[model samples]
Target: MPTPLYQRLAAHYRDAVAAGSLTPGARFPSVRSLMAQHEVSLTTALQVCRVLEQEGLLEARPRSGYFVCHPAGRPALRLNEPEARPLDPAAYVGMHARVSEFIARGRQQPVKVNFSGARGAPELYPAEALRQAAGRALREDPELFVRAGPVAGEPVFREVLAKRALASGMVIAPEEIVVTQGCIEALNLALRAVTQPGDIVAVESPTFYGLMQVLESLSLRVLEIPTSPQTGISLEALELAVHHGSKIAALVVVPYLQNPLGSVMPAVNQARLVNFCAEQGIALIEDDTYSALLDEDVPQRALKALDRTGGVIHCASLHKVLAPGLRLGWMTAGRWQARVEMLKYAQSRHNDGLPQYAAAAVMGSSQYDRHLRRLRATLNLQRRQVSDALLRAFPVGTRFNTPPGGLSLWVELPDRRDARALFAAALAEGILIAPGVMFSNVERYATCLRLNCGNPFTPEVAAAVQRLGELCLTRCRPGAVGSGAAGSAA
Candidate 1:
């Protein structure tokens, strides 16, 4: 499922184009120059240029060389972030219904173009390489097929994971890491280890639906804290919530490229969060699912990396950046490592050993780094393309987040138009979209929607976006009150 090397080399120019460093009509580097600069072979150089041309980023003239060709004249969008809400503790309810209905509708009807979930294309995953790795492992240890693995994951896989965790700014012992089915299971184990059934768990307003689902499944009440569309959850609001006596047991947060909003918490905020959680005796369950998708300059700033008190339960998955089919995610439970491992054992024993072997082989080898690089590159291009499409299709005042990483766009419709209405209309037209209200347990952000940019921005998708805009213009106009969607969603 992984992309070719030419795609990796093409990602360099793709980054430049995404950053606007290489504007429309800007000439591309010559093939010979690219070969010399990247230290690639002539064939790779040609393939890179070929991909660029095929993707419409470049056009070749009769005598002249390749030059940039992309969407032009799209106006720069201003940030119209959601209003901040004070600490309001509420229980999770019917969230799965909303999300399930959206999913079920897509399945029942034929979805022509999907913008619902933030999932990557198969080309972004390293499947063939993983197959080869699995083959090598099988040949090396044919008995592994019959042998049962450790209850806390194979030591070799844990060692590889611990070393890779260093890149996220945390030095971990392999013993502290328990490989789970995926990040979801890791999150489940963390929550189960920390709190009882009725205990309250704090989360950001308009948080990831999956997290809400987890809280619901565990019978945990939710205390909603106001979060910024730019920086992430506000520490001041959370402190006031806790100090005001919410009796919050744990805080489950995504600090990097958070889903729906696509916000990356700043380093200072990360430090403050860790310190606050530790001082407050609150278990900090940090989801590093999107940590690998953070911007290059801010890559090392994970909440766990700032944890000096070992209070942060760091959870991460290789499912997104590595082989997508291989369900491998690990978590270091810090002080609760024993409890987490016990919960994991009681729940599902351990992940399959064949996958562990394959994952370890891939992680230890050089292909892991290559997969991450090309994955980021491909995601960057997809984001840019989708952003351009949105700008061209949606009306003025339709605000969206342009994160340096991740495959999400939290779009606020013009004049507070109804996002659910748009969702229904888009579904009728065979296009799927995630309504913003689904992110919140209560009715909020009805004017907002999340668009996944993982797929290629095809002409058909561009047309679907245009149609969706037309629906937003006509179906959900701005003029109502009491319904949080029309009034202040603060």
Candidate 2:
């Protein structure tokens, strides 16, 4: 008889490792999904993964699931060779720094309304309460305040966070938690912990661009799975990528209210995704950054809540609700907690401890939920405002998604208009919007742009939209001159 399918999978993985194609710290396919892809049973896939684990090619990380291990003494690989550029300190700043600069000093004309942020209005923050909490933390716990914090962050804060997760139906424990500066750092840590340079990671086609920057900085090969604005990446497509021996280190996804597009995966898809990851022995990083803003009668179940095998690394931050300035984010890495904590120690120990205390105080005092409720109401109102504005302002042929909640709206421009150019033109008119090109790994969303709907409706914002409409009209006209003119400098 021919060698069994499980044996074949084990051999394929073994060969990939031997050839250094999969590299170290890469993730394997989930078993249930793999079974579906290969038309095999769960038992066979599990046996294959077990064989690989026993052979030392795969090591299981808690909560993170199984990953290819770096052989002892493997030097940390440098990702990309830095390019020579003008001697400017600002030029070397990372993507977030550039984004921050754009937010602060880039806009020349002062529009009446601001739509540049994917956040609730600044007024949503309980400024007085936070200031009081921070002051109280300093005065009451000077010992905790004046010391270097834990590598995973403060215990009491993490406990509070765990309780919060439990209340939300995520079943996380404090020990599995690692608080970070923000959701971005949590994402960065999980990526760094599981992936080495040259590893291929799978992501949604139109994912958060910042993550693409992370992958590029690490010199990781990116496998883009076609993502639907309504449901998420085709699960079948992802399964195919995994079965073809793609050395995917991890799958980073925002299952609830994904950025830019604002698409949320249904609960059934979420369960299938968890089962697939568990079956394939792969790690998943579930970013729930925007889930807190929903104001629906039926609460959607997070992917982490349905995870039976410890494969989903759940992450979120208080920034979207309580305050972005607080920069308080946490992750439950399940079995990957130790590795993630180690990386946290190696990175910066932690973002800041006092902020955690302040955040916990606000969250625990019952004020946080009330604040979130008000925020949801406000966001809902803004969501309608932007939706109506987009439909009314854009050309009749334009298309976009109307997400139930979240700050950004993904708009597809008519007649293949370059969003980058639109972005430049909008900026020249004292408007700022996220161009669609920024959301793709391969820069494929040139005809799209992400507009922030979190900002309140104001006359200036409406005027900016009208100006943007004029720009779109000009671009859509045939034989338009100088397509290259649209960009940040436009």
Candidate 3:
């Protein structure tokens, strides 16, 4: 598979912008000039220019040609080394009040700029297509709305999901799949099936707050293992904890494009983790929510694919990549399938049939594959644009690693700067951001923050980045207090 000509041309300019060669506000060549210089067709030249513009590296004036819009800024931040010590022993997960308040404010107040939520823009979804699919499903089976379906979900939907999972290297029967309201439900069920209250669960430090909330709700204690921004949770730390008699009941991890940090576990590590979990008799709860959004040429296999001992429980959803409003998610619990199914049935009888039918129709269509390709490209482009913006906006000494694929960028600010204060300040300006405290049970990442990169880099978004940069600079100055009191008034 050779690289497309337009992509090659786009890469040429992208490299220039990344380097200092083409400085900010530098005008790009005209379409005709580009064609002549590169010996390509008019269509290829136009596509190349469009790709750059979409990437936020170039802007087009009414009369002027496309010009580099990204300013020369500090170098990319260095990766944060994984912490070596064990996490602070905590019985409960805190920060519920703060997170609740943030959510309430987002709903009540009219935000000028939103950088908080991880959901993609509504326009990015295939809404009309899904609507059509729903209508077709309803017309095909008018009785679907009137009848109750199985607790394991609609049989047809599960069949489609089973077929689709094959692409990710998961081999499972339709009977083994259980549909839930969302991935959260699947995770909750998985956790409930394996362990009791007071049991210890191992999680990546600075993991998703929702997982912490789940642990808290279940009265489960957590052993936060050291995790890397590029490689995910450390196997050595995990083995040490197990060897030191941590008595870990289960391990919850996002194997591909992990949230917050965006780390993807290497294949070798995935194999090791599966084998280790099996040998230790610990159940592994794998969150595969973002797996479908991977932008890489060769998609990685799910952790469930290597489960020979039936220890890997896979949880996934389509909300991140497809129709979020559908609220459809599924899971395949290897050895714990029966327990998970029973728990799901007791909690919620079954998912709604209409949405499941609609999802099945969409997933079984060729259009779904096309939509994923476009979605992946758009997300990758947005990730780069946001990374460039962050590099230009934040002060020196900031640290972060560009994730291979995902919707977020985890940023570590200067030691003196408190991200909680930055969050409050940014909120006061009507720009929402997820402070680092929200992601961890402990206060390990107080100076860090996670930025959402699911949306496109429009002019409004660009201005918001600039404003956030200005706010950060102000806080970095001496005598600055980060109480975030200003946000309370708003």
Candidate 4:
């Protein structure tokens, strides 16, 4: 049942009082003002004031109406520790090992169906194109095999990437491009270039956990704002935080096909956000990692394209759609092009030329468009099939957002059931999934889970989904499924 109107209204006033917006001895607004502000009935407004008065946030005064009571409770504010401290060189060395461990864990475990990642089918990679490109490079330029490539990246790949950036609405020159191992390195370099140890950064709640690790490594404090799984960040809340001098060095966002939750910000909101960031002097790092996988006939203009003030930093990778092992990624930093490039030079100098050439060959081919079309068709069909399967397999009350395009699904199970528990059970059944707790800041998304629909529709996947469904029923009910199913899960 929906909450009572007066109870909701009373709690709002109580929160305001506790937050110190309505201080002690401050005059309360009249019943008419409350009526106008809340658009509630007179009785409801009176009830709200009565509840507040009883709770000691207000007091009755003769002829003057109610006055705010003294000694309101305010949340305890403490010194926020910087995410990192002055770490010696040893710390950086240890940090690398820690990150390596994270990546290794992601790959070493074999799941029943491997719905843990949004990786595409390896069969779709253009093997023949890569072979031909490597052969041509070796034959046409034998000297290229012995020498080190340019620190910036391969020239042909840079030109292609620049042209594609312009097509996506970014006004960029070839000189502004910097290629790295992949999007991970691209983001890492961007952060190293812009942020310092002990700096504060604002990230969307339930962001990519990989980004969280980056923040941790840098010792950067994270101020999380509630982000809508559909529309990106809450702009008004961001403006408020920035106004309070949050010392936010950058705002990293995935405006196109955001991870875990496939949300695309509308063009109008994108423009508003771009302007807001510019006016507030906050740098916007736009991560378009999944943009290429969009199934839309007309893709939305990227945030970098709408940057009139040179505040948007654009990063993307070919690993998602084309070649993961290629590890080729590029970025266009508007004003900090030099800083970004220097960091890239310091990191790995440049990615291997063979892979870049191979990716470039495939990207530069006629089959590129055909391959994307086929991929989209397959993805769209699979999306429907997976959604239907989930609906049919799981019982009622299982909720998830319906993304227009992308590979993953964000599902919210019944509150009584924990996704971590489901994860343990599924792992035993050889099914692995990304529990939603990993995506959130407060780790409150215990009942949420993300599913991958891009992999092959194997019999293992079918059995895993069926097992997951049965587990859901058992958890949501006291004794819905028999103990035999639970024993099998164990």
Candidate 5:
């Protein structure tokens, strides 16, 4: 499809804003002026501004017209990121119990507002469409309900997955893809295929807690690599770690829309990391759970796309943007394909046939593409609203990453505001949030926390956020800190 005229114009303006040519708080041209300058219809001009407005680049005023959304200098709503700290020494896992305790407490003390889990808004899910797809699959092969699926995957689902992999610039046959219970299982099998107990593995600092939990279960030691909030894992730091003799067996990373942090790795960075891993003989296990949430214009961020040595183990599932309940995930294990497949079977055996066919039915249709577009737009809007609300609701000196597109924002409390205290206070009031300490084993992120933008910004949610902010002011105690910025520097 040709690029929409409004989108092209919007991209142009977005670049100008990012380049500082159009500074923050600058006035946007009027609709008539834009039409005259671009020689387009009034509707096209209006659309360009509308897209910018939705993206938080431009703000519309009733009579003052549109200006830049974020003001030049206040700490609120800025994109300041936390300072990258030094890499800590490799160590065995110890956070699983703390996370479990936090979760258990929440189960006992249920909250009114939940910002803990990264799930999409209820309206974004295509319930009726999924139902129809399930019905079609059932009618086409009623025996699917009774028979076991192939150990790799149902052929229909694998075919669709192989075709869909092209979006990440990956070219793989259906046989190379190993279907699993979910993304979690794919990650587990990939790690198991490559490493043994007591082996050392590399993971991004403040990575998805699930990866940490998995490492803990496997009894593997971890080497935490510094990660950037804007671009993702630091290649220089990874090289430094490896150069200094950190015998890493494998590295688990999320190159696009990294969990908790919401960083999108640049294309060059992805290629370089792939080459580094391939040359060093390190298994690059990629968690691609959130890459589908990005726009089509983004560079092919998947490490598997540039994997020539067959070192990248690509893992992903539809839970983030598609049917969460489907429990379908697939992976390509590169040179370890056979071993990973065997591990998959030995671990869980073949998956059930019914859901695979149903997922394939929905994913094979044009409705899937339409659903992706809608889903991306919804996530972008939610991220923006939640970021804005955080700035408005949180205390001063606060910092946050205004991720380009994702379901959560990494928030740093201002004036030594404590996240654990916030978690405790919020829990008492029935509000839930993911504290930053759970994300890392070190003390660096003790004051930081991640807020899920997956839920809609309803009146109740907004009030809960406001209350949470009030709690931060009342319950949080001050302490010495190393450093912090106004917002993400992405």
Candidate 6:
């Protein structure tokens, strides 16, 4: 469990560079000198030097020794929390164009370091196990490949999902579950089932852009509620909105490992939210996509589990923890099961049976649990590594919250800094990051940003973080200019 010698050496130099002890263009100790100084073997010294080089901290000159090439440490900024802004009336979703442009740029010029999406690295998933499971399912049930299943889903897959739901403290019958293309489709179906055009829906402030797109596509008015990075959506603000005649029809919330913020709602708050929704006749749509990624020993119960009057609709997917390519997602619509089922059928006939059988095969076996255990551990470690890099690389005023269980970190830059500008500058350097303004319907969160920590923090990842830090420092410094130039590139 102790840190490896090479890693420790790398960290020491990384810290030195971050602390200004090692200035840019400064020469690093030779490999032999490093070995003699640290009493480490030549191989250990070489490995440490290689790691530092890979991290963009040290660079090798053709025939010369290694030299510190990274930017010097700047004064740490005072961490500032994003101020909660008032709810803005629903506006036309214009993020589609911006998001599309960002995506197109990434494709046109492939980014060296991608921190834009929330998906886990493919290496973290059990691809071989899933493939074997799918092969077995195909051999056992050949009909699954050729026959179309029911509108809701394949009965066997639904049954497997129902059994799996029990781990999250939900006990629902298989018939109540409806399979969809993914969580996004499930969300669309759930929103369509309970909401009408122009109806007011409450969402967490700084919510995922996908949800905003869904609301926009449906022509729904949004009411942004003040949310805490640590505790999730504020009940007090939500109750006030309801009492003040917001005419809110439905509430969509990501209670566990919320996107962007990575906050988990407390169990007490979860119960309170369910009861409040029931009393107020508001349908609560829970996006539980990341719920399965929580610690196995202390799994948090779903809001659907606490619903007594069937007012909670649970939407979840196995893509994040299992097979992302499968595009498998399910929804349990408590009281509006019929409506959701009908909406799903109308939108798209039942999901493909092939992937369902494949998923079912994996879920039914012990390999699924083992894979989850490894995934949870890997994600946690990756998150820590990224956090360390951010702290060391970013300016002093940078702020961030440690997520309880999630794949991304929400970072708040200095008040004077514009994350959108940083995003542009980073992209120019072949690094990709999610801007905070994309998450909000309003122009708030201009100083905030999100970083994907789902992938393992390899040397390339470390270098990317360092490059971002350098860019941020350049734009945010007291006498710095070119913020406009950075934005112009985008």
- How would you encode candidate 2's per-residue C-alpha lDDT over 446-471 as one tens digit per residue? 66777887777787777777778788
In the predicted model 1, the residue pairs found to clash are none
Candidate 4: residue pairs that collide: 84-219, 112-430
The lDDT of each candidate is 0.80, 0.71, 0.81, 0.71, 0.82, 0.81
TM-score of every model versus the real structure: 0.84, 0.75, 0.83, 0.75, 0.85, 0.81
Shift in Å, residue 405, candidate 4: 1.4
User: What's every prediction's RMSD, in angstroms?
Assistant: 10.0, 18.3, 9.0, 15.0, 7.5, 10.9
CA lDDT, candidate 3, residue 42:
94
Question: What is the C-alpha local distance difference test score of candidate 6?
Answer: 0.81
Which ranges of candidate 2 are over 4 A from the true structure? 1-114, 297-299, 476-490
Candidate 5 local accuracy as lDDT?
0.82
- Model 3's TM-score against the true structure: 0.83
Superposed by TM-score, candidate 2 places the C-alpha of residue 317 at a distance from the truth, in angstroms, of 1.3
Which runs of model 1 end up more than 4 angstroms from their true locations?
Answer: 1-74, 82-85, 480-483, 486-490
Which regions of candidate 5 are displaced past 4 Å?
1-67, 71-86, 295-301, 480-490
- Write the residue-wise lDDT of candidate 3 on 1-490 in tens digits: 9999999989998998778577553468899999999999999999999998887778775655777664444446446667555545635565567567767766776688788878788888888888888898889988988888999999999999999889889999999999998999999999999999999999987788888888888989888887877678889989988887788899999988888888888898999999999999999999999977777756569999888989999999988988889899999998899999999989999999988988888889988888888888788788778877877777777676567677877887764477777777877778888887777766667677888888889988888988888888886552232433111100
Q: On TM-score, who's better, 2 or 3?
A: 3
lDDT score of residue 149 within candidate 6? 86
lDDT value, residue 10 of candidate 4 = 83
Clashing pairs in 5: 79-487, 79-488, 80-487, 80-488, 81-487, 81-488, 111-430
